[model samples]
Target: MIILASASPRRQELLSLICDDFSVEPADIDETIENEIELEKMPEYLAVKKAKHIQGNKHFDDIVIGCDTGVFLDGIMLGKPSSESNAAEMLRNLSGRKHKVITGCALLYKDRCISFSQTTEVEFFELTDMEIEDYIATGEPMDKAGAYGIQGKGTALVKGIVGDFYNVVGLPVAMLNKKLKEIISNAEKKL
Candidate 1:
């Protein structure tokens, strides 16, 4: 069995593609970035924190997976927009520019763990204020990192992506599928 330490529908849906024996238990770890940590390392830090937080109080021995996703433009992290206005601002900042979407994942099974992060470069076409406002009105950016969901209404805001599309959607399926296979195969050896 596997346990996903997040309530994100995107993550839940992604993990579902791999296994049906997992349960959702969103971790309550503080997501604030450390003052001294580099921007590029924040995602990995949060992923590990979330995984360990849930792993520490385990009442069962199922494998646990924790993940975090963030968008960075010119080194500044764009977290989930706090409001419609904030979503517009984030989209405006990303207009006609390229940003990096990074997702970090951790897999824990008892005393064993594996963690990794993947980054995808996304380019947005020049968006007018009307376009941003219109996109925001669609109500798609509220729950997504970088104020957009590549797999939904937010696709109109993106011009192109230079890396894994699934990463932008919150999970790198190709990479995650490989890791999950490894975990399951190893777990079988101990069975």
Candidate 2:
């Protein structure tokens, strides 16, 4: 059995593409980044933390997957927007420039854990304030990292992507499939 250690509907939706038998077991992990931690390490670190939190529980022996995603613009990490204006600001900052979407995934079962990070470079068309404001008005950008959802209406703002599109959507499906197969193989070996 597989368990997902996250509350994100996006992560749940992405995981559903892989298997339908899995269960959701959202973990309560600390999301605060360490003051000394580098920006690039945030996703992996958080992913591990979330996975460990779930693995620490004694009730379940299933493989648990945890993931964290963030959007980086000019070296700053943009989380979910706090308000419509903030979402507008995030969209404006991403306008006509390339930004990175980083998502880290972790798989854990018992004491063994594996983690990997995927980075996707996304280019955005130059967006006017009206466009940004209009996007914010839809209420879609408020809950997404970098104030955009590549798989939804937010696609209108993106010009192109240079890496895995699934990563921008919240999971790196190709890399995840490879890693998940390896983990399952190892677990079978132990059995």
lDDT of 1 by residue, 9-89 (tens): 988898888777788889997787779978887887798789888888772377788899999998798899999999988
Candidate 2 residue pairs in clash (backbone atoms < 3 Å) = none
Candidate 1 error regions (>4 Å): none
RMSD of each candidate relative to the true structure: 1.4, 1.2
Considering every candidate listed, which one attains the maximal TM-score? 2
**Please, what is the TM-score per model?**
0.94, 0.95
Q: Residue 40, candidate 1: how far off, in angstroms?
A: 1.3
Cα distance off (Å), candidate 1, residue 110: 1.1
Candidate 1 lDDT score at position 24: 89
What is residue 30's positional error in candidate 2, in angstroms?
2.4
Q: Clashes per prediction? A: 0, 0
